[model samples]
Target chain A: DVKVTQSSRYLVKRTGEKVFLECVQDMDHENMFWYRQDPGLGLRLIYFSYDVKMKEKGDIPEGYSVSREKKERFSLILESASTNQTSMYLCASSPVAGKRTNEKLFFGSGTQLSVL
Target chain B: DQQVKQNSPSLSVQEGRISILNCDYTNSMFDYFLWYKKYPAEGPTFLISISSIKDKNEDGRFTVFLNKSAKHLSLHIVPSQPGDSAVYFCAAKRADTGTASKLTFGTGTRLQVTL
Candidate 1:
């Protein structure tokens, strides 16, 4: 079974602070993603990394960035945490199964971020 | 624009009954569809998926039916149990987007099963 681990399950930060949410996948998947889930917005992609040191902006990438220094780890960074940024953040990974991209994505438990 | 939509925000069903959750997509480019179930504090887990080439896919008690012409799909769970209560999200993607592509997701439908 594939395992995706988030470094923190819950985090609290003051406004204007810097915040980091880390995720690690054991399966060495080629693709990693960061998403934020809001009450009515569902899951909106923030950023995704297809390979080490390669990143792309998703639908909702403002005020957020990502790092993929290694194949197994992906990190989401908030330049300046704001109250509106408080939400549940999820990390997901999918392997490039041969030439065909994997359809199934395995997700982490999610980190609930509270910005006060 | 919301490419994918889960019109029903919530649904309630009794144990041993059949629960049908519906989803629709506006984009014609979407060729693959998927369903995910999520609990309150946990991330959404992949449930099942159907490709444009196939109309139906079944796994255990869950069966997903797709209508390519209508751009819609439905997930049916028979003999629903209490553990089935969760938020079910309908997602879709265009297979042409390659490995870095992301799936477009609907707002999600919360399913509650009563004993």
Candidate 2:
């Protein structure tokens, strides 16, 4: 069983403040992803990392960035939090790409961030 | 453009009945499909999946049926229980494309089961 742990279950931040959402996976999967969930928008990818220090922008990456300094940890950074940035953030990991055609992602419990 | 779409936003079913959730995709490149169940405040869990090669895949009381020509899929849960009440999301990704193989997910269908 792959266990993906999120550092915070819920967080509240003020506008213009910087925020960090951390995630760590125990299975040592090579791919990590950050997504934001919104009503009518579903899960939109914000950023993803395939290797340490390597990151790629997903569909919606504005005002957000990610850091992957170690193999097991991935962090999502909100440069300047705003009321619109409030969302349920999810972290997911999967085995190395192309390892299997039918591979599925293991997701962390998620972090609900509220920007006031 | 939103490749995957879940037309119905919500569905209600009585216990011991069948709950059907539908999904559709516009991209023909999508070869693999998956269904995930998400409870409130929790991440979605992988329920079941079906490849383009197969039209139907079943696990326990959950079944997924895919129609390639129509580019649509549906998940059917028989004898639905209260525990099955949650948001169901349909996700799909193209075949074995190493790095850029990101999945496109539908908005989701919220299912409520009444006893």
Candidate 3:
């Protein structure tokens, strides 16, 4: 079984503060992703890393950034936390099963962030 | 644009009955579809998936049916149990890009089962 662990399950921060959400995977998957879930918006990708030191912006990358210094860890950084950033954040990983049509993502529990 | 949509927000069923959760996608390029179940405070877990080449995939008591022409898919759970209660999300990916597969997900449907 694959295990994905999040650094914090719940977090609270004040407006204008910087925040970090971390994720680690035991399977050494090559791809890692960060997503935010809202009521009507579902899961929107924030950022993703395909390899160490390589990152790409997803559809909703604004206000968010990512770090992949090592193969097993990925981190999401918020430059300035705000009420709008308060939501459930999820982390996921998948092996480079193939370029297309074959990757299965495994997800971590998720972090519920509250910005006041 | 919302590429994927799960119209029903919630559904309720009795034990031993069949529960069907529907999902629709607007993108024609989507070639792979997946279903995930999530409990409160937990991450969504991979349930089942189907490729464009196949229309139906079954696992245990869960069966997923895909209608490519209509851009719709449904997950049916037979003899639904209380343990099946959770939020189910429908997700799809284009798989056109190399290395990274970005998934588009639906809002999700919450399933509640009662005795």
Query: What TM-score do all the candidates reach, one by one?
Result: 0.97, 0.96, 0.97
A30 in model 1: Cα distance from truth in Å? 0.6
The DockQ of predicted model 1 stands at: 0.69
What lDDT tens digits, residue by residue, belong to model 2 across residues B3-113?
Answer: 999999999999999999999999998999999899998998889999999999999999999999999999999989999999999999877556644777899999999
Per-residue CA lDDT of candidate 3, range B4-107, in tens? 99999999999999999999999999998999999999999989999988999999999999999999999999989999999999999895857776788999
User: Cα RMSDs of all predictions?
Assistant: 1.2, 1.4, 1.4
What is the Cα-based lDDT of residue B75 in candidate 1? 99
The CAPRI category of model 3 is medium
Residue A24's lDDT within candidate 1 is 98
Report the TM-score of the second chain of model 3 against its true counterpart: 0.97
Which runs in model 1 stand beyond 4 Å of their true positions? A97-101
Interface RMSD of predicted model 1: 1.4
Instruction: Report the C-alpha lDDT of model 1 over A8-115, residue by residue, as the tens digit.
Output: 999999999989999999998999999998877788989999999999999999999899999999999999999999999999999874445488889999999999
* Candidates' C-alpha lDDT: 0.93, 0.91, 0.92
- Candidate 2 versus truth, CA RMSD in Å, comes to 1.4
